[model samples]
Target: MTAVEFDAPAGLTGRGAGVPLSRWAAQWGMAVLRLLRSTLFVGIPVVLIATIITYGLGALTDTNPAAQVLGETATPADIDRMNHYFGLDRPLVVQYLSWLGHALTGDLGRSYYTTLPVTDSISQALPVNLSITLLAVLIAVLLGGALGIGAALSGGGWFDRGVTLLCSAASTVPPFVIGIGLIVLFSVTVPILPSGGYVPFSEDPGRWLRFAILPAIALAVEGAVAIARQLRTSLVGELRENYVTGADVRGLTKLRVVFGHALRNAAGPAITVLGYSIPQIIGAMVVAEAVFNLPGLGKLSLDAAGKGDIPVIQGVLVTMIGLVVVSNLLVNAALLRLTPHARRQQP
Candidate 1:
C-alpha cells in the first residue's frame, strides 16, 4: 500500500479524526434533553403529591391559625376576620389552589406568627444550611475518596482492614452524637472552635469558617464512611475485571491502570451514594443544627412545626423536596456522562 493509504486507515481509527465535532455535540445535546425529560417526569408528580399532603396536614390540624395570630383577648369576630383574611374560611381545595398558585410565583404566604413572608424567612436561613451542607459534602468526597482508594489499592492488607473497621464504627454513630462529641472536644475541652452559632461568610470569612467547620465535620463523618465503603467495594470489583488485567498486560503503570481506568469505571455507584447522602445529611441537619444552634432550614422547620406555623412549615418542606430533586437530577446527569452503560440504557 502507498504511504497515504496506510496513514489514512490509521487516521480513520483515531477518535478525534473519526468522529465529527457536530456528531459529538449532537450526542451531548441529546443526553441533556433526556436528562431534563426524566427529571420532569419524576419531579412534577413528587412535588404535586408532597404539596398536597403538606396542605392537607395543615388544614387538618386543630391549631387555628387565626387563634395563633391573635392573642387570647381577641374577640370571636376578630378571629373570624383574620380567618377570612387568610382565606381559611374557604374550602380546602380552594385554599390549596390559592396557596399553590402563590407558591409558584415565589410567595409562600406570610408567617402566621411573625407576619413576615415565608420566602423572606427561607432566604435568611438558606445560606446557613447551604454553607454547612456544601462544606460537609466537600469533606466527605475528599476524605472518602482517599480512604476508599487507598483501601482498595491495599488489596485486603492491614490498611484495608483498618479502613473497614473505622467506617463500621463511624457509621453506627449518629451525626448529632458526633456533633456533641465534637463540641466537647473541639469547643469545650480545646476551647478553639465555637460550640454553636453561625456567621455569614460575607461578614467575616475567618469567623464563618470557624463556626462552620465543626458542624460540617459532624455531618461529614457518616457521609464519608458511606462513600468510603461504597467506593472500596466498587473499586475492588472493578480491579478484578478483565479490562484491568488487560490494561496491566498492556504495560500501563499500576497507578494509571488503577486510578485512570479502574476508578472511573467504579465511580458511578459511589456518585449515586453521594447523591442519596444529601437528603440524609439534610435530615441529620435538624439535630446537628440544634446541637450547634445554626439557624438553618432544619431548625426553622422544627420551630415552625412546634408552633404550627403552617406557611413556614410548608415552605421549608417544599424547599427541601426541591433540593433533593435537583440533586438527583444532577447525579443522574453525572452518571450518564461517566458511565457508558447508563447512557446506552437511556431511551
Candidate 2:
C-alpha cells in the first residue's frame, strides 16, 4: 500500500493540512462498507450459535416449558396440548428454523412466562437498560477525560500523582464491588442515597435521580478509570510535541495552549479507545442492574433464562448483539473524525 497525499479540497483543507476531502470521503465510505460486511459475516453466525446454546441450555435444564406456561400441576393432557400449540414438540432444528424465520421478519414470538408478545417485553425493558448505560457512559467520559487532561498538563505534580493513584485503584475494583461499596457507603452509612432501584424519569425526576445516582456511579467507575488512564498517556505524549511547545511560546496562556491546542490532538486516540470501550459499559450494566435490583434487560434476561422464557431470552440476546454492532459502526465513524490524519489518500 502506498501513502499518497493530495491537495485539500475547499473548506475541508483548512481544518487539517493537505487532507483531500474527496479521498477522505471515499476512504470513509469503504471503511463503513468493510465494517458492515465483516460484522454481518461474524455477527450472524455468533447470534445463531448463541441462540442454539441458549435454547439448548433451556431444553436440557428446563424439564417442561409447557408446564411453566400452563401451570406445573396441570394435567398431562393440558401440558401436551400446550406443547403442541407452542410447537415445542417439534425437533430442535425445525423449531430453530421456524424461530429464525420469524426473527427475520422482526417477530420474536411470545414469552413463555407471561405469554405477552416478545417485542412488548423488550419495549418495556429496553428503556431502563438504555438509561443506565447512556448516563454511565456520559458521566464516565466527561469526568475521566477531564482528569486525564489535567493529569497530563500538571506532569508529575501532586495532581498528576493523585489522578494516577485514584484511577489505578478504581480500575482494579470491579463494577459489582463498586456497587456494593456504594451501597455500603451511601445507603447504609450516610443514609443519603437510595441503595438501588429504578424510577422512570418521566414520572418523577427527583426520585429517579435518587435511584439512578448510585447505579450510574458504580457502572461508570471502571469505565472512567479506563478512559482516564488511556487518555492520560495520549495527552502526556501530545504535550511534548513541537506544535504544543510552539503554541506555548507564542504567548498563549498555559491553560489555553494545554487545553485548547494540546488536548484536541491528544483526544483523537483517547476518543478512539473510548469508542471501542463503550461495550464494556453495557457488559458492566448486567452486574450493576442485578446488584441494584433494577428491572433492566440484565435482570429481565436472567429471569427469562430461569423460567425458560426462550422468546424473551432470544430477543434480549439479539438486541444486545445489535447494540454492539451499531456501537462499533458509530465508533469507527467517530474515530475517523477524531483522527482525520489517519485517513489514507489514493494516488
Tell me, by lDDT, which candidate is best. Answer: 1
The ten-residue window of minimal lDDT in model 2 covers 5-14
Per-residue CA lDDT of model 2 for 1-347, tens digit only, reads: 33333332222222456557786677667766765776788778988898898778767774688887777579999998988888989998889889999999999989876778888888888888788787888888898898988888789999999999998778788889989999999999999998877898889989988888888888888778878888899888877766656665566698876666666667766777676667888888888888999988898889987777888989999888777777767776666565555444322
In order, the Cα lDDT scores of the candidates are 0.85, 0.79
Poorly placed runs, candidate 1 (over 4 Å): 1-23
Candidates in order, TM-scores: namely 0.91, 0.88
Residue 6's lDDT within candidate 1 is: 16
lDDT score at residue 69, model 2, on the 0-100 scale = 72
What lDDT is obtained when candidate 1 is compared to the true structure?
0.85
Reference-based TM-score, model 1: 0.91
**Candidate 2 CA-lDDT value:** 0.79
